[model samples]
Target: MGPTGTGKSDLGVALARELDGEVVNADSMQFYRGMDIGTAKLAPEERGGVAHHLLDVLEVTEEASVALYQEQARAAIDAVLARGRVPILVGGSGLYVRAALDRLEFPGTDPRARAEIEEDLARRGRSALLAELREVDPESAERVADDRRLVRALEVHRITGRPFTSFMPRREYVRPAVQIGLGGPRGALNERLARRVDRMVERGLPEEVARLDAVGLRRGRTASRALGYRQFLEVLDGLSTVEAAAEATTTATRRLAKRQVTWFSADPRVEWTDFREPPEEQLRRALRRIAEAG
Candidate 1:
């Protein structure tokens, strides 16, 4: 696992090929159908004949639930293990990755309280609710930069009568496995992301968004918020130009990469290697670490 555009997907396929494993996607955006180009999902030919599970399992209009994802992803991993093939969980969605591998439990949601919070958010604005969250759960408030996540944090605190950070993941894994992180400096990652966004635009991200918009992409609470997709949707709506959308997408993607790095780096168990390392060297190191871990 690693930040976006850090070659995690390519390395995942390579590792699966070497170990006779299957790839189980942990990226939240890749879960939705018709979001291929924007999410950088690998085409079938690009998969190098390694079977992948949990990609394209959701409609663009559907919401993604980490709790549900935990159930399905774990089942897929268990099946792969039972068949004597390794399961390589891949992607940079840190929470989804943790939900699939860690001993983490999602707190039950209270719709009534959540709706009330939503009302408050619409009425009093995110700053008001965020101030309240700061008083109750400052750690979560600091960590969650978005209003939507802040709202959820406030809702969780209200319902469970607990600090939102109480649900922060522990370092313990729920299964016997090794986590390999692709690490590089921040400047390098930002440059990579800018190039990636440029490639996405050249590859018809705007056209893809137009197609998805006709299919109810706007209704998807999760899919609608995807980085490039959201920005390009504004382009289609005449709210922004292609250049503006590209700029926004690149900026948002860089921020996401930083968050992913922070989230994965906090876990002491993850074995990290330089992103610039040769794939052969990285693979050998990963295999050695897995052997040692076992």
Candidate 2:
């Protein structure tokens, strides 16, 4: 897996073709229908006859849960393995990728407890909750900078009496698998991401967002906040210009790429290849790594 525009999708398809594998999408945004252009979703014809799973499975209005995704993706992987085809999990969503492959357990949600915590969060604000989290799960509180995540950590701690980081992914994979990471320098990735954003707008990202608006994309907590879509939605609402939106999208995407890099880099087991490497070489390296891993 790699940052956006780092050519992970192309590599995934190439590797799948070589290994007789089906592709499993781990990108969160690609889960929605009609989010194609904005998400840079590969067209069916572009998939090279390699069956792809877990794309277009969710409505734009629905919230995406990593726990639910874990179950569905694992089942897909099992089915692919049963058919004697490898399953290539591909995406820049580090958490979803980890959820699918790592032996990570999600804490059960408590609506009543969650409602209460959310109410407290709204009233007391993040500073107060962050202070409490520091008292309980200091590690997670320190690592998680957002108010939403801080609330979840505190809620999980209150419900389970365990540190929030307890649910964090370990390096070990639950299945026999190999993780290949694509790496590039920060400056190069930023330039690539800027060009990609420009390409997305030229490819009708604004029109795609307009179409999805009828399907309740704005109501989707997760979908609405997606990188390019949100900025373009503002463009539609007359709150921003196409130029401003594209610039915002580029900036946000660069930040996202940095985060994805940091997240995947933490896993010592990942075999990384430079993004500048030839595709055929990377494919041979991935195959070799998989064989060695086996």
Candidate 3:
């Protein structure tokens, strides 16, 4: 996986064509309908006749959690395998991607309690919520990186009525695929990200966001949280000029790319490729690795 606009979708498309495979989207944003451009979703012609699953499958009003994504993606991958072609999983959502390929098991949820916890979250942002979770479940907080994960921990604890620290016995998962990273030194990647932001604006990302609002995907839900969309929404609300929004998009995108770089660097399974490498070369190396696995 790579950062947004790091050519992940294009590489996935090219690789799917090369392998004669179906594309299963691992992107969290692309799952929402009417979010086409900002999520960098492939157009009909761009897909090159390859069947793409899990794109535009839900209304933007719907917010997908990792567990839901895993469930659907698993089904789609099985369908692709049944067709006797490779299933190419593509996107920058590391959590959904890894959850699908590695079969990680996040604990179950209790709906009523989840609602309560989410209410609590609204009242107190991640820090206070995390502090609360930490007081009750220090070990889980220690294991997970941040408060963004407190929601998951609280869900598990509230559902199971058990200490969140006791999740280790549930770590059984069978990995199904190889993972890799894309991009290079920070300076080079930032340049590429800026150019990508420019191109996205040129392609009318602002119009795309307005169209989503037309389709009643107006709320700042999960889909709207995709990089360029919300910035454009600010422009829609007259909170910022288009130029300001574009600059903010580029800045936010840079920070996201940096986080992605750090995430990939820490991931042992992800062999990386520099942005300078041709996509075909990266595809060839990946295919070779898969073949060797056989």
Return the TM-score for each candidate structure: 0.84, 0.88, 0.84
Per-residue lDDT over 1-294 for candidate 3, one digit per residue giving the tens place of the 0 to 100 score: 877666777777877888889999988888887777667788989988888999988887787888888888899999998999988888887778777777366677677877888889888877787777778788887776754567878888877777676754222335457665677778887888788788888898889888887776656468777788878988989999888998999999898877777766766777676657787787887777768767
- Lowest summed lDDT window (length 10), candidate 3: 167-176
Please, what is the whole-model Cα lDDT of each candidate in the order they appear?
A: 0.92, 0.91, 0.78
| Weakest ten-residue segment in model 1 by summed lDDT | 168-177
- In TM-score terms, which candidate is top? 2
Q: Using alpha carbons, what is the TM-score of model 1?
A: 0.84
Stretches of candidate 2 off by over 4 Å are 115-163
Model 1 residue 223 lDDT? 98
Model 1: colliding residue pairs = none
lDDT of 1 by residue, 1-294 (tens): 988988888889999999999999999999999999999999999999999999999999999999999999999999999999999999999989999998887888888999999999999997898889989998898888887798789989998999988987777889887999998999988998899999999999999999999999999999999999999999998999999999999999999998889888988888998888898888888888888988
Query: What is the descending lDDT order?
Result: 1, 2, 3
RMSD of each: 4.0, 2.9, 4.1
